[model samples]
Target: MSWKGFSLDSATSERRRPGASRVTAVKILIAGGFGAGKTTLVGAISEIPPLTTEAIMTAAGVGVDDTGGVPGKSTTTVAMDFGRITIAEDLILYLFGTPGQNRFWFMWDELARGALGAVVIVDTRRIEDSFAALDFFEHLGLPYLAAVNCFEGAPRYDAEEVRQALAIAGHVPLALFDARSRDSVRQTLIAVAEHALRTLTAGRPRP
Candidate 1:
């Protein structure tokens, strides 16, 4: 949220290397429900090969996860996925994708520490699945944006309706997104970060 003052610019020529930078890294968590494409979004924009701990699916996972939402996704994020992107020569956004299951919910706060904000992915086909993610963000009081993942058979709802259903302000970012597309994911990231910046700059609410 308060980054340009924190990290290097987008040009990034000053750093010369990935890990070398005068500015501190800006952390951002990408969170959502199981099969919500958290890993996909991370891979889409990562400059490096994403460090994913995905493995082959087992029969035990059947009926446990919504395979219908992720076709050909034999592997899932076990712990977390890490990637980095340079927003500007002055800022670097480091992204961490949380494990995609309710059982892993307890790890969120730890993962979110020092993070600017989050991009909560929602699968409109399974609207109920997104509640946990939204609730987590609201509870953490982090500025976030909801990105509706465009899935097959996903319900068609206007942004306003989704906002009201989620009990979020209309100004909150809720946009149609396809996680597999680099440009789409990048846009979603920008929107959430921008919201966090605005909220940070606005500071505490008035009495």
Candidate 2:
């Protein structure tokens, strides 16, 4: 397949068996507000070593970046986080994590190109921080799900409460997940994948 003039192939040079199924690669985006755990989710679920572009926090961002809720955050994603996971023998997922800071938002359009869907990670402590990401995907008409990153010390709310707080549509899938848990992250990814599939199906012209 081709994305932005770049060709991407999941197959290798070696020959495959007569009955073997060809692998399919799908791109997915992990996006949310600052310090919402987009990077953590990608790293935890990635089968290979995750590629991170984190840079240390500095005085340069004093007034520009907001660190109120997450005072202990010492670094931020300067560009993007990249990872890969093989969901099944014939399916692979390429994860791209967008930088949470607003300054890097210009790159989101490029990162979102050809993406199947997105997972918007929300921190209950600062739920408002996620509104921008939610609005972005909604405006783009992209299929996305909301995942509440269960951070320790943050107040926990039921799915309905979060759904109301975010003002998301009833059809949008919402779930709780721990960014550090591989199993939890995997389930969230599966949910978004299923949601995207359903969305695409609904948009297709009936035969």
Best candidate according to lDDT: 2
What is the per-residue lDDT of model 2 for residues 74-117, given as tens digits with 9 covering 90 to 100? 99998999999877666678899999998999989888887878
Residue pairs of candidate 1 with colliding backbone atoms: 7-90, 8-89, 8-90, 8-91, 9-88, 9-89, 9-90, 10-88, 10-89, 11-89
- Per-model lDDT: 0.75, 0.85
lDDT at residue 45 of model 2 (Cα atoms)? 95
Off by over 4 Å in 1: 1-24, 62-73, 151-153, 205-207
TM-score winner:
2
lDDT of 1 by residue, 94-150 (tens): 899988776567778788777777898887766677788788878777778898887
Q: In each prediction, how many residue pairs overlap at the backbone (N, C-alpha, C within less than 3 A)?
A: 10, 0
lDDT of 1: 0.75
